[model samples]
Each structure stands twice: as structure tokens, then as C-alpha cells.
Target chain A: MIEAIGVSKRYGETVVVDGVTLRLPRGGVTAIIGPNGAGKSSLLSMIARLLPMSAGQVRVDGLDVARTPGAVLAKRLSILRQDNHLPARLTVRDLVAFGRYPHSGGRPTREDAAHVERALRYLALEGLAERFLDELSGGQRQRAFVAMVLAQDTDYVLLDEPLNSLDMQHAVAMMRLVRRAAEELGKTVVLVLHDLNFASCHADHIVAMRDGRVLMQGSPAAIMTPEAIAAIYDVEATVHEIGGRLIAAYFA
Target chain B: MTAARDPRLVLAVLGALALGSAALFMTWGVNGAWGFALPFRAAKLATMLLVAHAVAVSTVLFQTATGNRILTPAVMGFDQLYVLVQTVLVFALGASAFAGLDRRLLFAGEVAAMIAFSFLLHAALFGGARRSLHLLVLGGVVLGVLFRSLAGFLQRIIDPNEFAFLQDRFFASFNSPHHGLLAIAAAMALAASLLGWRALRRWDVLSLGREVSITLGLDHRREVTRILVMVAMLVSVSTALVGPVTFLGLLVANLAHAVMPSFRHAHLLPAAFLLAVICLAGGQAVLEHGFGFDTSLRVIIDFLGGILFIALLVRGKVR
Candidate 1:
């Protein structure tokens, strides 16, 4: 479980994430939906300890995120940020193998290699494992990043804008992978998503943010209503239930 | 991606070539007394090898910390800071007093000052703001400009004879080295390399960049500070021993990356060291024996290195 108590981020007089307090339960896919400048990424980064919180405390499984050693925290939690400017020369396998760094400390053993191989296979990157990151397509490279995070074997995964550059097919595939990771592997996953329909259809729980505060939080069926959507995004979007899944048509 | 060459084979070839150059440098033009001439040549040989190791390792480490192949310690003004120290000594003590001071004391003072400067710079820039690596580089470049201008102003105001003496010390020279200074430098470089040797794997991860390194559980700030101190010691060693060779590190490090083409520092570090050895020893042998000291080794190296720098820029290989 991750808990943020009065979390806030400020730059001088401007507050990017202002006084956000929320509890995120363990074991499921939780999607954070918000508009631009809604502080979705900032909140997630603070939770991951990538960004320092201004006036709040974040604890993961009773361990203060800021006080805990990175090595200890890395074993329990892992994060993959969007726009990873990595070296293009690293092979998919080499990149994924780094996921075991906290455990093996760069000296990989047989078991570490097995974990790397499983990650590659799980991401369907077995054929492209030997290929360099620069040689792969955008979707394949995105999958490679996911494979690396998966190989970390952390119980909680934080992904910031994981579907940023992926196409429709790849985006859906990534969402499915996130769901499987939560349901099958019993890992807790948090994602900052842009598409309302994707978040509504895939996420087990949804948290809506506007102006750095949680506008609403509940199951998709409750948060996907027209009133909630208007209040959160300030757009009058009709919500339709098709195939027993609440899908919001916010584009039109 | 193209087929990758085996790093071991490349390293072996570089090691052999470096050894061959050293052998050739020692053997050529030994008509004088064997006992008298051998130690003299050996001193010069040891000096070249030490400078090669210090400059190459420091450059590679600096690039790793900065996450770019283009920026070396020399480019960051480390060598310029050494020059400033030398200029200040001459300006304060006058020519005779400066020359009369104990060379060992002077070397120690220069090295200590450089390390102190690096620590101050590291703390001031990286302490509170958590400034990015590029910002630090920009600060270094600005500081380099300040140091160069100050040194130049001092040279202009000093006596012409003193200026002549100072000018001679500015350019790098491998022809003659102080035996005492060479011994101290070798010990220091050896110590730094030992520290570097244990952290070779960590360096490989660090080269990935700051965010990735931190996410991998490395204390990025602490690691970068340690690497900077090592770089300061190294830059001081080479610059104090043979003066400043600005482009040698850039040339050697880029060549090492090109040849090894692996992210692993285990292969990259030795490859850069060996390549530096080859460039210095082999180039010195050719210039000393073949050209009869008609050309300066620093001139030739900077010429080739400058050209390579421009080529890298044209190819957009800064990353």
C-alpha cells in the first residue's frame, strides 16, 4: 500500500501539485486521469521518490519513501518514467538485464539471467532481444522498457505516461500487460493515463485529479459518469456502457 | 545493428600495439652508453605511460559522469586550471624564486590546489540546486575562460624574461621529465586506477545517465563527487608532469569507444589507456628518431585530435 499525506509540490509561488492526500491500495491496476498541468505525473514521481515532495509524507508499506535506502526501496518498488533518453547501443537483452542490478549488483548469476530471459519472453521480445534499442520500432522499444521494469520483480510498479508514443494496437497491448501484471502476478500497478476510454475499460480503480487535488476516486463505473467527467475534465462527455464496460466518448 | 567485434580481441591487439611502441621507443637510437642511456630512456618511457594512463582514465571517467562522449576533462577546463596555478606561482614568486622552489613541493601544491578546486566546484554547483550535468559543464567552461584570461593577463604584466619562462611551461613536453615527480605521479595514478578498477561495473551503469543510475540504486550525487575528485587528481598529475595536452584525452577516449563499441568500462578503460600509450610512445618514437625532434609531439597530437573533434561534431556524435 502507498499512502500520500498532504503531498504538495511547489516552485516558488506556483504550486504544481497542491496538497494531494490519497491512499492507493495494493494489488490491482490503478489509473490516474487528469488534464494537462493537472499534476498527475508530479504526484506519481513524488510517490516514487523521483521528485521531492514539498510539504507531505509518502510511505510505501510503512517505509518512508524518502528515508529508506534506494536499494531497499528499489527491491519493493520500481518506476519507469516517460521519455527515457537511454543509450541507443544497448541491446534489448542487455537493457533488460540491468533490471536485476539492485539484486545482482551488475554481476549477473544464473538466476538473474533466468529472470532476464523470462522478462524478454513475457514482453514478446525474444526475437528482438539481440537487437539494439535503436534498431527496434517505437512499439518494440516501449515493450523493451516494460520488460526491463518487469524483470525488476518489484511488488509495486509505477509507470508515468507509459502509453505516450505507442500506437492504438501497442497501447491496448500495454494496458493488457499492465492488467495481467496486476491480476496474474499479484503486483500493484499505477499509471498516469491520457485516454479516458482506456482508463475506464482497463483500470480496476480510477483516480481523477484536477488542479492537483483528487476530484473523484472509485471503481470505473462510478467515475465514468457524465457528471464526474464534466467536473474532472470540464468537458461534457456522454458515457456509454458497451459490453458491460463504461466507455467515455470524450473526443467529440 | 552491425555485427559487433569481440572486445577481447580488440583489447589484445591494442595491448600488443602499445607494448610494441614502448619497445620501439626504448630500442631506437641507443648508440650511447647502455647503462647510462637505458635508465634515461626508461624514465621518459615511464613518464609517457603514466601521463597516458592518467589522462585517458580521467577523460573516460569524466565523459561517463557527464553522459556524453564529447566533453573531456581538458574541454571542461581542468588542464586550464592547472595552467592558472602555474601562472600564479610564477607571478607571485618571480622567475628565480619560482625556479628555485623544490619541484616536488611545487608538484604537491599544484595537485592539492586542483583537488581543492574540484571539491569546491562540486559542492557549490551540486550541493543545493541539484544542477544538471550540462549546467556543471557550462559552469566549468565559464571558469575555464576566466582562468585562461587571468593567466594571459598575468603573462602580459610579468617581465618578458619571466613570460618566456612561463610560455615554455605552458606547452606539453614529453622529452624530459623530473624523476622524482614521475615517481610520485605514478603512485597517485596507480591509486586512482585501483579505486576505478573496483567501480568499473558501476561506471558502466553510470554511463547510462543520471536518472537511470539513480533508479538502479546508485547514489548518483556521491558517485559523481568521487569520480570528480579522481579526475582532479589525474588531470593534476598529467598536467603537472608534462604540462597540458588538451586533445590527447579526447582522441584516445573517442577511439576507445569506437573500437570497443561496448557499454562496459571493463573493456573501454584499458582500451583507452593502451591507445593513449600507443599514441604517445609511438608518436614520440617517430618524432624523436625519424624526424630528429623537428616537430613537437603536442603539436602533432593536437592537430590530429582537433581534426577528429571536428569530424565527430560533423557526424553529430556528441551524445
Candidate 2:
């Protein structure tokens, strides 16, 4: 389990993530949904130790993230940010292979190769594994990045805005892959999502944040009420039961 | 598999060409005094090779660390710092007093000052604030301008004869290296090269960017700091050896990247070093023989290297 206690981040005079305390369970999909400048990405970054928190502590599996060695924490947890621009020319397979760095330290063993292949196969990227990441389409590149995180095989996977450039079909497919990873691989998946319907349909738990603090967090059934949606998003969202899923409709 | 073809054979051929060039450099003046002429030219040859290797390796590593092709150790105000140190020495103690100073002591002083400056700059800029790399580059440019202006101010105040001596020291001059500084520079370069080789594997991961490197379990801050220190030391040695050759490193590092066509630093580093040596040695040979010794080899290299740098910038090959 990943736990954040009184975690806060301040940039100069402004507080970006203010006093966020939450516990992400061991195995399931948890979605953090919020508006722009809601500090969702900042919270995720602090949890991953990508951005240092100004106050409070974060622990992963009882190991203090700030105090623990990076290598040890990296084996247990991995994170993928929204924008990843690399200067080197790398193929999809090569990028995926880097996921084993914490284990093999860049010298790949036979088992590492097997893991890479499995990740590529899981993402349906086996055919495009050898192609350069720059040559692939936007959706394909997004899948390749997901494959890399899956190849890491960490217990806790944190993805910040993973659906940024993805189309609807690919976004659904990506969420399904995340759900599968949680269900089959028994991994804890936390993602920052924008679309309420997708979060309602896919996530086991939904966390709503407004301004650097959690507005509400519970099952989709509990947090999908019209009053709660309006309170968090400041828009009248009519909650309706569609295909046994509580979907939020706010457009028009 | 074909893409992964080992560059060892190509490296061997380049090594052979270097050796052949060295042999020619040695025998080109064989009929002169054996003791004085041969050893003097040999000292020049050794200094050239060492400086070339040092600059090439440090520039490539710097580019990898910064994730930009155009920025080099020079861009970080390293060469500017060297000039500042020289100008300060001359201004404080007068040219004659500075001339009387021990060459080894002077070299050590220059290297120590540069290392300290680099550490201070990195720590100050990247320590607290979450500033971007571009900000750091901007700071470096500002510092470079400040150092150059201060050095120029000191230059203007010095006596005419002293100014002449200082001017000679400013421009790169391989033909007249202080032989006493050669051994110390070689040792420093060798130690840095060893450290760089040990970290070669991590360098490939670092080139992927910060988030990936962190996710891969490499401590990004620690690795970048260590690489920066090594780069500073290497640049100091090369600049102290033959003065500053600003664009040679840029020219060679980019050429190596273009020729190697791979992201792996294991092959790229050696290729860069060899390319540097070949360029320096061959350029010197042609300047001495083909050009009838009419001009300094530094002029030729700077001319070509400057053109290549401008071309790279115009073509947007920097990032």
C-alpha cells in the first residue's frame, strides 16, 4: 500500500498541493479526477518522489519514499508522467527493455528479455516492437509507454494523465489494460483522469479534488451523485444509470 | 542484429590511421637534432592528442547530460573561467611576476578554481528552485559574458608588453605547449576517463530524460553532479594544455554522433575520442606539410569548426 500523510507542496509563495493525506490500497484501480490546476498531477508526482514535498511524508509498503534508496523504491513502485521527450533515438522494444534497469542494471538477462516480450505482447505491440517510437502513431506511442511501465512489474503504478493525446477508443482500451493489470497482475494502479464517465465505468474508487484538497472520495456509486458532482466540478452533472454504470452527463 | 554490428573493426582502422599519422609527425623533422627536435615535437604531439581526447569526451558527456547537441562544456563558462583566471593572475601580480610563477603550480591553481566554480554554479542554480535546464543555460551565458567583460577590462589596463604576452596566451597555440604541464594533464585525463567509462551504462539511461532515469532507479541529481565535476576537470586540463579550442569539441562530438548512428555510449564515447584525435592529428599534419607551415593549425580548426557549428544551428540540429 502507498500512503501519503499531510503531504503538501509549495512553490515560492503559492501552495500547489495542500495537505493531501490518502492511502491507496494494495491492489485495485483508483482514479484521481479533478479540474485544471487541481493539483492532481502534483500529488501524483510527490507520491512518486519525482517532486519533493515541502511538508509531510509518503511511505510505500512501509518504506519511507523520501528516505529510502531510489533503487529499492523503484523496484516496488514506478511512475509515468504525461510528457516524455527523449533526445536519443530509441525503438519501442528498447524503451520497454529499460524497464528492467532496476533489476538487471542495463545488462539484460534472458529473463529480462522474456519480460520485455510479455509486456509487448500484453499491449498488442509485438508487431511494432522493433519500430522507433518516433515513427509510431500517437496511440501506438502511448501504448508503448504503457508497455514500458508494465514491463517494470512494480507493485504500485502511478500514471499522471496517461490519456492525454489518446482518442476515445484508445483511451477505453488503455483503461481496460490498466484494469486488467490491477485484476490479473494484482498491482495497485493510480491514474489522473479527466473524463468522468470513464472514471465512473472503469475505476474501483474515485477521488475528486477541487483546489489542492480532496473534495470527495468513495466508490463510483457513492461519489457519482448529482450534488457531489456539482459541488466538485461546479457544473450540474445529471447522474444516470446506463448499462449498470453510474454515468455523469453534463454537456448541454 | 545488423544494426548492432560492433564498431571495433572500424575503431581499429581509425587507431591505425592515428598511429600512422603519429609516425609521420615524428619523422617529418627527423634530419634535425635527434635529442632536442624529436622530443620537442613529441611533446607537442602528446599534448595535442591528450587535449583532443579530453575535450571530445567531456563535450559528448556534457551533451548527454544536458540532452542537447549544441551546448558543450564551453557553454557553461568553463573556457571563460580559464581566461578570467589568466587575466586575474596577470592583473594582480603583473606579467613578469606571473611569468616567474611555477607552471605546474599555475596549472593546478587553474584546475582547482574551475572545479570549484563548476560546483558552485551547479549547486546554486539547481539546488533549491525547480528551475528548468534552459534557465541554467541562460545563467551560464550571463556568467560567460560577465567573465569575458572582466577579463577584457583587465586586459585593457595592462602594459603593452605584458598585453602582448597575455594575448599570445589567449589564443590556442599547440606548437608551443608548456611541456612541464603535460604529465599532470595526462594523469588527470586518464583518471576522469576511467570514471566516465564506469558510468557509461548509466549515461544511456540518462539520455532518455529525468523521469525515465529516476524510474530506472538511477539517482539523477547525484549522477548529474558527478558528471559535471568530471566534465569541468576534463575541460580544465584541455584548456590549460593548449589554451581554448572552443568549437573543435562541438564539431567532433556531433560528427561522432552522426557517424555512429547509435545511442549507446559504450561505442559513442570511444568513437568521439578517436574522431577528435584524427581531426587534430590530421589537421596538424596538413597544416604543417600541405599548407607549408604558413599558418597556425588552430586557425584552420577554428575556421572549420566555427562553420560547422553555425551550420548545425541554422539547420536546427541542436536539440
Candidate 3:
């Protein structure tokens, strides 16, 4: 379970994330979706402890993110930011192996190697495991990063804009992987996504944020209403239950 | 694809090369009495090894922390600051009083000041929700220019004899090893290596950048600060001992990275250290035997290293 209590982030005069209190459900896929500058990424980063909060506190499984040591939280939680630029030359497997750093401290044990292999297989990147990151396409590189985060084997996974640079096919595949992580692995997966239809079809719960605050939160069926979609994003969209899944058609 | 050469094998080969150069430098053309030649050569060898290790370790850690290969601790104006400190001492107290000051004490003071400068600069530039490394580097470059100009101004106004003494004190001289200061340099260098070993594994992870490193459970800011302090220690040790061999670190560090395909610092550090040793010891040998001491080894190193730096810039890999 992840809980944010009156959390806020202020950069000088700009309040990026306003004070908000919420508890995210465990063992489910929760997607935070909002328009640009909606503070979705900022909120997710605060919960992951990747960004410092200017006010209030965040707790993960009864551990205060502000007070707990990073090493301790690392074992139970992991996060992937949007952009990852490595200065050193690293192959895909080499990078995935680093996901076990909290446990191995750079010395990969046999068990850590198993995790790396499993992650590579899960992302369907076994063929490219030996390929350098610079040699891969944007989508493949994005999957490689996602593979690293999954190899962390944390109960709570937070990703900020994981779908960026990914094509539609890869995007759907990524959402399915996130669902599998929640269902099969029993992990709580939280991600900030911009694509409304993808969030509606894949997420168990949808969090709509706007102007640094949560505008609405509920099941996809509840939040998929036309007014709610318009309230979140200033666009006219029709929500239709197709094959028992809420699909938003904002095109046209 | 050509299989990558095992970094360990490269490390071994470089180690052998470093040793070969060290041996050649130690005994190359010693026609004098064995007793007299051995101690003199040994002292110089010890100083060279200390400076090489300092330059290697400091450059590796600084580049890791900054995540850029082009910026060494020298860019922070440490070498120039060292010269400025020496100049002010000579200008204020004269050569007699400066010479009378214990060399070990002066060396320790310089190291302390260098460490203090890193801490102060980091604290002042790294806060306010802005960990802008660009700002830090810009500030450093600006301050480096300022320090150089101030040192130049002081040099012009000082007495001619004092100026000459300061010049002698400033440029690195490989031929002369102040044997009295070797023990102090060795002790400090050893302490630095111990701490460096403890943080060795973390350096590879650090190269992944701050967000990923923190997500991997490292206190990135704190760890970077620690590495910078160690870097400061090393820069101070080498600069104080040999009057600041500015380009040696850049030359050897990049060479190590280019030669080894591995990303592990454990492998990279040794390769870099051996490269430094080979460059300095081998160059010293060539300067002694081939050139017959007609030219300074520092000039040769700076000349090669400067060209390499410009090449790296032109290649557009630094960004």
C-alpha cells in the first residue's frame, strides 16, 4: 500500500504538486492519467521517493519514505523515470543486472543472474540482451529500461510515463505486462500515463489529476464518463463499453 | 562482431607494462656506485607511483560523479589554486621563510584547503532544489579563470628573485623528488585508496545517473559528495607533490575507458592506474635515456594530453 499525506512540491514560486492526501490500493494496476502539466509524474515521483516533497509525508507499507533508508525501501519498491541516459557503455543484460544492485551491490550472485535472465525473457529482449543500448531503437530501449525495473522484483512498482517513445503495439504489450505483474506476481503497479484509452482499457483504477491535484479517482467504469473525461482533459470524447472494457474514443 | 577483450586481461597486460616501465626507469643507465644510484632512483619511483595513483583514482571518481569524461578535478581549478597558495606564501614570507616551513606541514595544509574548497563549492552550488551540474561546472570554470588571473597578477608584482623561486616551485619537476614529502604523500594516498576501495562497487552504479542510482537505493547526493571529497584529497596530494600535472588524469582515464569494454569501476580503476604508471614511468625513462634530460617530462605529457583533450572535444563524445 502507498499513501501520500498532504504531499506537495514547490520549486521556488511554482507549486508543481499541491497538497493532496490519498491511499493507493495494493496488488492492482492503478494508472494516473492527466493532460500535460497535470503533475502526474511529479506525484508519482514523490511516492517513489525519487523527488523530495516540500510538504507532508509519503508512506510505503508502513515505512515513511522520508525517514526510511533508501536501501530498505529499495527492496520493496522500485521506480523508472521517463528518461535514462547512461554515460558508460552497457549492454542490455549489463543494465538489467544493475537492477539487482540493492541486493548484490554490483557483484551479481547466481540468484541475481536468474532474475536478470527472467526479466530479459519477460520483456522479450533475450535476443537483444547482448546488444548495446545505443544500438537499439527507442521502443526497444524503453522496453530494456522497463525490464530493469521489473527485475528489481519489488512489490510496489512506480513508473513515470513508461509508454513514451513506444509504438501502439509495444504500448499495449507494456500495459499487459503491468497487468501481469499485478495479477500473477501480486505486485502493486502504479504508472502515470497520458493515453486515455489505454488507461481506460487496462487500469483497474483510474486517477485523474489536474493542476497539481487529484480531480477524480475511481474504477475505469466510474471515471470514464464524458464529463469526467472533459474535466480531466479539455477535449470532447465518447466512452463506450466495448467487450466489457471501457474504451475512450477521443479521435475525430 | 569482434569479441570484447576481457577487461581483466587488459588490466593484467597494463599492469605488466607499468611494472616494465618502472623497472626500466629504476635501473636504466646507472653507471654510478650502486648504493648511491639505488636510493635516489627509488625515491623518484615512489613519488611517481604516488602521483600516478592519485591522478588515476581522482580522475575516475570525478568523471563518474560528474558523468562526463572531459571534466577532471583540475577543471575545478585545484592545480591553479595550489600554485596560487604557493605564490601567496612566497610573496608574503619570502623564500627563506617559505623554505623554512616544514614541507609535510605545507602539504597537509594544501590538502585540507582543497577538501574544504570542494565541500564549500558543492554546498553553495548544489542546493535550492537545483542540483544543476552545469551551474557547478560554469562556476568552477569562472573561478578557475579568476584564480589563474589572480596568481598571474601576484607573480608580476613579486620580487624577481621571489618570482624565480615561485616559478621553480610551481611547474612539476619529475627529475627532483622531494624525498622528505614522499612519506606524507604516501600516507595520505593510502588513506584515500582505502576509502576509495570501500566505495568502489558503488561507482559503477553511480555512472547510471542520479535518478537510477537513487532508485537502486543509493543516497545519490551524499555518495556523490563523498566521492568528491576523495577526489579532492587525491587532487591535492598529486598537485602538492609534483606541482600539478594537469593533463595526466584526463589522458590516462580516457585511455583506460577506451581500452577496456567493461563498465565496472573495479576493472576500470586498475586499468587507469596502470595506464598512468606506464605513461609517467615510461615517459620518465624516455626523458632520462632517450632525450638525455634535455626536455621536461611534464611538457611531453601536457603536449600529448592536450592534443588528446582537443581530439575528444572534436570527436563530440563529451556531451
Q: For residues A1-117, write the lDDT of model 3, one tens digit per residue.
A: 899999999988999889978899688999999989988998988888888899989999999998899999999999999988675568999999989999888778999999999
Model 1 accuracy (lDDT, Cα): 0.87
TM-score of 2: 0.92
lDDT of 3 by residue, B248-304 (tens): 999999998889888888888888999999999999999999999999988888899
| CA deviation > 4 Å runs, candidate 3 | B32-35, B86-102, B124-138, B155-165
Which candidate has the highest TM-score of all? 3
Q: Which pairs in model 3 have colliding backbones?
A: none
lDDT of 1 by residue, B60-117 (tens): 9988887777778887788889899889989999988998998768877887888888
- Of the two candidates 1 and 3, the one with more favorable lDDT, higher being better, is 1
Q: In candidate 1 chain A, what residue range of length 10 has the lowest lDDT sum?
A: A82-91
Clashes (backbone N, CA, C under 3 Å), per candidate, total 0, 0, 0
How much is the lDDT of residue B25 in candidate 2? 74
**In candidate 2, which residue pairs clash?**
none
> Poorest 10 consecutive residues of model 3 chain A by lDDT?
A82-91
Candidate 3: residue A103 Cα off by (Å): 2.2
Instruction: Summing lDDT over every window of 10 consecutive residues in candidate 2 chain A, give the lowest-scoring window.
Output: A83-92
Model 2, span B139-161: residue lDDT tens: 87788889889999989988988
Q: Per-prediction TM-score of chain B?
A: 0.88, 0.86, 0.89
